[model samples]
Target: MSTWRIRLSLFLNFFVFAILLNTVGIVIKRVIDDYGVSEAMAASLEAYKDLSIAVGSFFLASYIPRFGYRRSMLVALLAVTIASMGVAVITGFWITPVLYMTIGVSFALIKGAVYSTVGLITRDQGEHTSLMNLLEGIFQVGALAGPLFFSVVMGLHFSWNQTYWIVALLSALAYLLLLITPLDESEVQSHPEQAGLVEMLKLLRWPLVWVFVLCAWLYVMIEQSFGTWLPTFHERIFGLDKHIAAGMLSVYAGSIALSRFVMSYLSRRIPWLPTQLTMLGGAFVLIVSILLTTAGWQGTTVDSWVAVPPLAWVFSMMGFFIGAIYPTIISIVLNKLEKPRHAAMTGLIIIFSALGGTTGSFVVGFISRSFSTHDAFYFPLIPITLLALMLIPYKRLADRFHPASPGG
Candidate 1:
């Protein structure tokens, strides 16, 4: 089978979803201004999107191998494409949640298929880690471009809703590419009877899986806190123009993309645990420094990047340090499991990740509304500290369970 075509299709599918998923921050800002929604109400968008992801992944993910990876991805693309078109034609605050619900459900299928497909395409643990990083790196690229795409669209005198038309076009293109791509799932499909919700839920029986789940959950909480709110932070905290605030998220996404690409190269050279720990430490220091320096600081209105505070730039760099953590942890867990179990395991991961993202965004939104944006930024410190502590045991368990696995 030609793996490159399948790989390209996966990349395109992931890229499309990344843009739609990460645009929550920008969309949140827009709904507040255009629809007159409050911060807490806007935060429900995350719940709409993420809760659907959790529900979809829980029900559909285990069966994906039998349903076929290619078919699952194609279905996801088609659904999101239609949803985007619907949002473009229909304009209202009510429609926004509907669009995101579509996006969330569709992403569950796309992500489950992509993660499982990586196992089929790769030959070994090292290859798995490298490909995972590259795949996630591409996701970050989409994340980086998503805000910029919105900025440019709005800059052309188009409303944010019109951005969905372009997204619909992109989804159509990805759907076509995936429709033509061939993926061989015979290995995973061999025991079709074993793929079930019961078996998938059984993954939680293992202590390692539980610990890993907590880690995944905490990591995403931290990630979504920033990913879903940075634009709002920049806009409100720094008093920047909305477009500039939204565009500034590119810094965060770009840093993450760069870090993941770098990790793709370095994963082979460095130990995963130490590298992850070091990155967490760096993130901890930077986040603390930003919190201290920006405390009680009133932001002045800034029209351009030149006037944006240097500390805001420092805060964005948190992405660079944390970017590699998710893929690295995923690679570690999946590398230890047999290929047949990859889809089920990935389903479990996605479920927790979605829950984490939803919870994190809600908490931050509450904090920002109740307290202040600066206070909201401090929420990540708890997760960061917990994730750092969790890594030690996770590393030990990985080694104990799979002594010879490259991920250890």
Candidate 2:
């Protein structure tokens, strides 16, 4: 298969993966509530998905080059298709956890394989950043639209559980795309004898890797907290109408996608540290402004929008500025590792990245539940602070890893 064809397939597959992931958080909530599972236990379903991804990535890290990216993604798509259909068929609350765990497993493969493949297809930072940025923006579109798509379906037909079938069909179509598209063999894994997990760990002995993982994990929690739950937060605390609350999330994610599109070009001019630090610091101001202006967004009604609240604007700004940081982190990861070790390192990076996704609900849930929901917004500040502090070090390290691309 042609390399461009493979790249297209990868982008489409990744977009499909994004929708499934973002939608599930909204989907399972109704099912779990109806099942009468406590909020915390029901929420743990997502954590299981992350845990599975982390474990799967860890174990499967070494062999992806052997199986190949297309095959790994294909297998992951099939798993998701089956899991989505299973949720539609099953009635017992007992099975929801299993299906979610299965999703975690599938997503682990697709994400680990897909993210690393970005490095494989492109030549250097500029081309890679542009492609990753464009693709990630579309993923955010899917994220923004997926929940609303389900919302419309549930609204029109009141068939909440039935929503899984549509996702199943989409997954099956993506599976077919994988089957038909050609794949490039991953350079990281072409060898007959690749580094084993133990050997992989020797490379990971660098403290920098763990630091990056923590940064990835924390940023996810922050973004997902507002992205996934911001609507609810607005609905409950600010007395914003439901429609407006939902739109609030749109503005946030839309901004994220937009920023990345620009960062695709912007990265060419400014260094990553300065760029990241500026965005992070800006986000810090927004977060504090958000918390201070609203009297606390705990129980705002969904139907009533009493003019756009000031904090709603903060969420929108956060989304746009936060966009490139993720792909930036991945770029840094790819640059840091030598070619032979890239596949294994990519897997662990993806695992923590996935963990960050899973951490979204737990962080929000526990923080909001233990303290006031309004206070929960402050939780993300801790990681944002850490990421900002690391900016100088990250830059110094990034220089050794990725010297500037030669001048035009």
Candidate 3:
């Protein structure tokens, strides 16, 4: 009923969504071994989910204001709840694409609605960034739990399909919680421009929007590549057991949550754009160093701290830096626009992020399938470097357009 209650409900819903979203990564090896699909085939699952999100968001985003964020979220929750059940009941590898597609489309609605609502609730860019970071931090905690939870379910003699039932139950609970809460769309400020397909197209006219789009795309690409493929990389490169490999991914996911938690506070003191560029630089150097070092190591083992390359530690911990980029950029973009455009811009944000995710998974999968997983690490280096470079121009644009709250 109250504002905080709605925000709380959103956090819970996003947490549930995060688990289901990350499952593709956790289950990739299982899909490969169970279904006999190649690495590329398993990797294409990202495309199914992300492209669905992209297409769905592109088409459905403008309608959020008309349908109301609350109603759209209700539909999204119910849809995903049913879809998760479908995942459990459905049999065989052929169902995988359908399962991912259902989740992707449902999430498109949920994300467009929730992000739009956030812009409504927060008073200014500072609060917006903080709340966004906190919400995403909760999502990362769910991601951190995903692989470990999947491994636990598998170890208990449960089928991987059973994981969907957990998602189903969580969604059901989130749906019920939201059912009772009140959301006031009128409290939100409306954009001066008319709300429709035309207005959505008009947003692309701004050069700043393009920069944010590319930045969002690059960040998600890197995030998904690591999120979707890290388990397979560990298992394939190091010969670790599935459970161990999956558990290792928690490091990456956990760092995201931890870093954002830190950023929610650091945002109060540190300048955002400068800090972000420095972190990206560190990430580029770390990833390149890992690739070179990994090539020289004859055999891979997860046996001991001393045995493994420092890459694993640095790579997993890279999430600390990467975590703040997305939410911060989202805040930056939304802050630049009027209230009416927030919903559509959020959709565009999802669109590029989804496209980037699809491209990242496909590229990494193709490279890993054709060459080695180690070599696939080279792919992200370009994006990382480019992201840092793009930020220089983006900072100028933000300062020029929003002088009062330049970094917020």
Candidate 4:
């Protein structure tokens, strides 16, 4: 089998989902302005999306290998394609939840399948780490495109629902690509009997797994706080037009994409832990400076990126420091495990990640509702600190598990 086609299919799979998943922030801003929903109500879109991911990953991840990775991804794409079309036609705030719910569940399948399939294609830890970062970088590219895509649609004076029509089309194309791409799943299927809920549950019993789970949870909490709410932050706090605010979010996504691409090269030459820690520190300082700079300033309407506050640009820069964190941690943990356990392990990672994203978005939204969006920005500081602390133990355990592997 040609690995390149399989890899292309995987990249396309992630690219499509990245756009769908990261559009939460853009959609939240839309519902608030167009549908007249409150911050908290709009925030529920994250819950509807992420909680479904958590639930779907918990129950379906372990069994994906048995179901076949290609088949799983195809089904996920089909589901989301249909859901996006429904949202495009239905055209109501109420239908928004259903679209997100479909995305969440479908992504659960896509992520698990994609992560597990990486283990099948790669030959060693270095290849695994490099490919994971590259895949995630492509994901960030799609994420960047998502906001920009919506910005164009809104700029043309189209309803946000119309954006779903394009999403549906992209998903349909991805579905066709995966359908034709052949994947060899024999290695994972060799022990199909071992792949089940019992084996997945057993992963929870490991101390190292729990530590890693904590790391995933915290990292995603920080990332989602920005990914799911940054547009709203700019629109509400910086007083940018809705389309411009969404367009500005592309800066954040683009930063992450660039950072991850850089990491794909640097992960081989550099130490992961130190690099990650330094990135976290940079993020912590940047967030504090942004919050302090933007404080007490009443929002003013701005029509162009040129007129946007300089400090507002700093908000998107947060992506530069934090982009590599997710793929690095995922590569580290999955690299430590055997191929047979990759799907199950990836499932655990997805479950915690979904939960963390939901918690972060909801907490920030609630805080924004109760206090202000500026005040809400402070919430990620807590997770950033906790994640930095958690990394120490996570790195130690990862080293203990694979003594021959590079500890960093």
Superposed on all Cα atoms, model 2 deviates from the true structure by an RMSD in Å of 4.4
Which tens-of-lDDT digit does each residue in 118-234 have in candidate 4? 988988777788899999999988877787788799899999879988888989988998887888888888988757778788777667788888988998899889987999999
Q: Report lDDT (Cα) of residue 270, candidate 1.
A: 77
Q: How do all the candidates rank in terms of TM-score, highest first?
A: 1, 3, 4, 2
**Model 4, 306: alpha-carbon shift in Å?**
2.0
lDDT of 3 by residue, 4-117 (tens): 789988998899888878778656778898778899989889788877887778888766777778888899899888877887888677788887887788788788788888
TM-score of 1: 0.87
Candidate 2 lDDT over residue span 1-408, tens digit each: 346777777767777777777766675687666777787877787777667777877887656666676787888888878887887888766777787777777776776577667777777776776677777877887777778778888898766767778878888888887787765565666663554576456555665666667777877777777776777777777777777877777788889989888887777677677788888888888888777877533543545444676656666678776778888876776665654456677677776766676687678778888887778878878878887776566655555643122110
lDDT tens per residue, model 1, 1-408:
779988888888888999999889789989999989999999899889878988888888888888888898999999999989998898789988988998988888888889989988988777788889999999988877787788899999999989989889999999998777777788888978657687788777667788899999999999889988998988887788887776677888888888899999988887888898899999989988888877777888989878988887888778999999999899988877767667788889998887898889999999999999889888998999999999999988877775234333
On TM-score, the leading prediction is: 1
lDDT of 2 at 138: 73
Which of 2 and 3 is ahead in TM-score?
A: 3
Which of the two, 2 or 4, has more lDDT? 4
Per-model TM against the reference:
0.87, 0.84, 0.85, 0.85
The window of 10 residues in a row where model 3 has the poorest summed lDDT is 399-408
TM-score of 4: 0.85
Q: lDDT at 82 for candidate 2? A: 85
Q: What range of 10 consecutive residues in model 4 has the weakest lDDT sum? A: 399-408
| Model 1: colliding residue pairs | none
lDDT, model 1, position 216: 98
